[model samples]
Structures are given as C-alpha cells and as structure tokens.
Target: QQQVKQSPQSLIVQKGGISIINCAYENTAFDYFPWYQQFPGKGPALLIAIRPDVSEKKEGRFTISFNKSAKQFSLHIMDSQPGDSATYFCAASMSSGYSTLTFGKGTMLLVSP
Candidate 1:
C-alpha cells in the first residue's frame, strides 16, 4: 500500500515568485517520483520527476528533489506566472514491473499577475 502525504492543500504565489510543494511517502518500494500539472479542464501532464537513484532533477522552470532516506520529495516552480496556476499532484510508483501509482490529494497553486 502507498501512504503519501502532501502539504498545504493550496498555495498562492506572485508572478516571478517561486512556488514550492512538498510530499512524503511511507513506502520504500516506491522507486519513481513524478509530479503532474493539471489545468482547469485538461488531464494532468508530467511536469518533472526524479528517481530514487538521483537526488534531484531540473527541467526548465520546474524541479523535483528526492530524499531517499527521508522518503520525501518536493517540487519547485521558479519564476511563477499567472499562466502557471494549476493543480499539482505528487505521485509514487515502481519504475519496474507492473504497479499502480499512489497519488497525494494534490496542491492547488495560484499565481497572481
């Protein structure tokens, strides 16, 4: 079973500010951490991800950091903008074999213009 906890159900960030979201899991079997970004009426898209073997991964303005010892990870959005407002979900899954993803409740991010 996957027990993942995500914090700060919602967040407000000003344009050009940085947005941070955190997540912690209790399952060591999880090997992959993927952050999904969802818009009002669209499916969630993979924003960034990090594997257990790596400490962090950065893509454009997004970043994901992993802490294997703590079983925690976080997503950071640099230079936040009004268009970046969306719901972010932190998920965990096994990279190998067949496994379903365990997702946190999700964090609603709002960036003001």
Candidate 2:
C-alpha cells in the first residue's frame, strides 16, 4: 500500500492547450498529497498539493484534483506552454514526522510550439 501509479508516461500537447495526468494510490494511511514538477536532472519541486481534507488545490497554472474516497488524484495544467515541458510526478506522504515520499512513475509533458 505504498505505490502511486501514474499514466501516459509521456504527453504531447500544443501551446495554450490543457495537459492532464492521473495517478492513484493504495495506502489509506497517506494523508498528504503533493504534485511535483521536475526539469531535466533536477529533483522534483513541489508544484501544488492537497490534503485528504480537501478535494482540490490550485496554484497559478497548476491544479490538483483529489478524490479521497477513490484514493486517486490528478494534475491539470491550464494554458500549457512550451516552457511547461518537463517531468511531472505525483507523490504521497504521511502528515506526521519524516516520511519518505512515494512517487509515481512520472509523466513527461511535451508542449510543442
């Protein structure tokens, strides 16, 4: 119950379009949900996050929609741009103490001009 599986290992979208990626988890003990964005060899950075107490969270161009009962979450990029091209990872962690994050396989987003 520690796995978070993501899909569409890669994605291609045009500028100004929407980019979507989905992920699911098995651990009910996980209470913190976060989406991270990585460029090249750099470590993933927290782009946005949600808790089991919330259904959704948004920041700038990034949005995370969460379903508590289904144990699923998704990232939605609005008005995606070529600069948005990067690897996106969905992760889960516990709210208490120092818990290692469980990351999804990752989704490579390619926004072509």
lDDT of 1 by residue, 1-113 (tens): 44999987999999999999999999888998999999999999988888999998999999898889999999999999999999999999999998688999999999999
Report the lDDT tens digits of candidate 2 across residue range 2-110.
3999987999999999999999999999999888999998988889989989888889989899998999999999999999999999999998999879999999999
| Residue 66 in candidate 2, Cα distance off native in Å | 0.4
Q: How many residue pairs clash in each candidate?
A: 0, 0
TM-score of 2: 0.95
Candidate 2: C-alpha lDDT? 0.93
Candidate models: Cα lDDT each: 0.93, 0.93
Q: RMSD to native for every prediction?
A: 1.1, 1.2
Q: If scored against the real structure, what TM-score would every candidate get?
A: 0.96, 0.95
Model 1: pairs clashing at backbone N, Cα or C within 3 Å? none
